[model samples]
Target: MDVAGIARIATEMTDFSTKEAVGIAVLKKAIDINAAGALALIEVIPDNSQSAPNLPLNLGRNINTIA
Candidate 1:
């Protein structure tokens, strides 16, 4: 996750705006910060497989367009 990487993502995302895309970009930045260390940019926990409390709300759905 270097400046070049961020710029590349930005260029690709210029076509349209999406929350997911933005979130990915943010994670990329975090990973780049600690390139030499173990940077946990993302944690893929299976849905309904883990037990945790006070988790953030997930819409569990996606909107194609703003109506």
Candidate 2:
């Protein structure tokens, strides 16, 4: 997939903030390096069909926000 597709999938799969989203978009596309930063942290939440490991308490705060 292209950068846009990757960004979209990342967006849908995680609950990243606006700044984080832009940073991820920029990184994935390499169209803009200005937005890259540590704020782009990601949290993955697996669906019923998928198996996911339990994240540490500090990392699982944004789990299962998707509909």
Against the true structure, whose lDDT is highest? 1
Candidate 2 on 4-50: residue-level lDDT in tens? 99999898767657778888877777744434432343334344344
lDDT of 1 by residue, 1-67 (tens): 9999999899878845676788899999988887735435344445542554455455445576876
Worst-scoring 10-residue span by lDDT in model 2:
34-43
Q: What residue runs in model 2 are displaced by over 4 Å at the alpha carbon?
A: 1-16, 31-67
Candidates in order, TM-scores: namely: 0.28, 0.22
Report residue 63 deviation for candidate 2 (angstroms).
54
Q: Per-prediction RMSD in angstroms? A: 18.7, 21.8
Once fitted onto the true fold, the runs of candidate 1 whose alpha carbons sit more than 4 angstroms away are: 1-17, 36-67
State the weakest 10-residue window (summed lDDT) of model 1: 36-45
Judging by TM-score against the true structure, name the best candidate: 1
Candidate 2 whole-model C-alpha lDDT, 0 to 1 = 0.62
